[model samples]
Target chain A: TQLLEQSPQFLSIQEGENLTVYCNSSSVFSSLQWYRQEPGEGPVLLVTVVTGGEVKKLKRLTFQFGDARKDSSLHITAAQPGDTGLYLCAGVSGSGYALNFGKGTSLLVTP
Target chain B: NAGVTQTPKFRILKIGQSMTLQCAQDMNHNYMYWYRQDPGMGLKLIYYSVGAGITDKGEVPNGYNVSRSTTEDFPLRLELAAPSQTSVYFCASSYSEGREQYFGPGTRLTVT
Candidate 1:
């Protein structure tokens, strides 16, 4: 079973739309990170939330960590075509060095 | 710094053949990791090293081997490659556990 589960496996929206992607797990994490990946490339880190109930914003993107540290959400406001790509959520459990990744949410923003 | 780098961006190996995927990080991070990403399945950890000479298996370590003899290099080896082993391989490094990681462009490997 996947340690983390992401919702909206695939999403397609026109430019200027807003959407939110969720990452959920029953296990608490020491830290949660969001990454965006383009085709044929590695995932690039967008943001990291280490404290529970933390909210971070990077320009138009907003990231929230659940108070329980078991879930996270990424919301993009006024999405642009450049926002299209695969968004993956990863978490580090307290006991290990390996990261647990969610399946990912593929987003396509059309002009 | 180059941060993280991987060699042979693409490769194709016949079944039963063996090859190694090279990974190096110039950042001198103490933690390095290998992960395999299959379509829609996200990235699964193949192996990881906390430091030189200290390696551990991750969630999916079958059919794979790794070694970390130096702080900057962590290579993943595949023995008796199979079709099921075909996927995009990513190398990542972090300063410490639970820290943000830097990733390599990745290597696409196909085993026929």
Candidate 2:
């Protein structure tokens, strides 16, 4: 079973539309991270939420971590075609070096 | 500076063939990791090293091996490559064990 579960496996929307992706898990995590990957490249770190109930924003992207540390969300506003990519959520379990990643949400934006 | 660099951006292997994927980081980070991504799946860790001469298995360690002889390099070895091992491999480095990691562009591997 996947330790982290992401909803809306795929999304397609017009430019300027808004969308949100969810990541959930039963286990608590020390921190949660969001990453974005393009077609031929590896994932790049978007943001890391360390504290419970913390919300971070990067331009048009916003990330929120649940107070229980078992869930997180990413919201994008006025999405553009350049924003189209695969979004992944990862959780740092305990003090280990490995991260538990969710299946990921693939977003496609059209003009 | 080059945060992370992986050699052989793409490769093809026949069954029973063996090869090593080289990775190097110039960030002076102490933690390095190897992860594989399959189609429509999340990236799964294969191996990791905290420092030179130290290595550990991650979530997906089968069919793979790793060595860390120096803090700047971590290489992954695949023995008897199989079709199941075909995927995109990524190398990452981080200053701390559970912190944000910088990833390499990735290496695409195909096995026949």
Candidate 3:
């Protein structure tokens, strides 16, 4: 079973549109991270939220961690073709150094 | 800095065959990890090493083995390749615990 659940497995939107992708889990996490991966490349770290109800911004991209620490969300404003890629969410579980990853959200923005 | 490097970007193996996937990091990170990502899925950890001599299994460790003989090298070995093992393998490294992991481009393997 997947430790982290992400909604809207696939997303396709026109440029300049706004969208939000979510990651949910039953267990709380110490820190949650978001990554963006392009085809044939490794996933790049976009942001990390450690506090409950915390919010972070990377340019036009926004990330929010649920107050309960069991969920998180990534919102992109005025999406561009450059944002097309796989968005993944990962959380630190138990006391281990490994991260539990969500299946991911595949986003495609057409110009 | 060539953060992390993986060999043979693509490979094809027959069932029951065996091979090793090489991973190396130049960031001087003591922590190294191996993960596999299936089509349309997230990455699942296969194994990780804390230092030069310590290694541990992760979520999907079956049919795989790992060795960390040095701080900069961590290679994953497959004793018997299976169709179920076909996926993109990624190697990552971090400076310490709970830090951002830097990943390699990945190795796409296919078992026939």
Candidate 1: list runs displaced more than 4 Å: none
Tens-digit lDDT string for candidate 2 (B23-72):
99999999999999998889988999999999998888999999999999
Residue A63 displacement in candidate 3 (angstroms): 0.5
Minimal lDDT window, size 10, model 2 chain B: B39-48
Where model 3 places Cα greater than 4 Å from the true spot, the runs are none
Model 2 lDDT per residue over A1-109, tens place: 3399998999999999999999999999989999999899988999999999999999999999999999999999999999999999999988767788898999999
**Best model per DockQ:** 1
Q: For residue A58, what is the lDDT in candidate 3?
A: 94
Candidate 2: list runs displaced more than 4 Å. none
The candidates' DockQ values read 0.79, 0.78, 0.73
Docking class of 3: medium
DockQ, structure candidate 1 = 0.79
Chain A TM-score of each candidate structure, as shown? 0.97, 0.97, 0.97
lDDT of 3 by residue, A79-109 (tens): 9999999999999875758888999999999
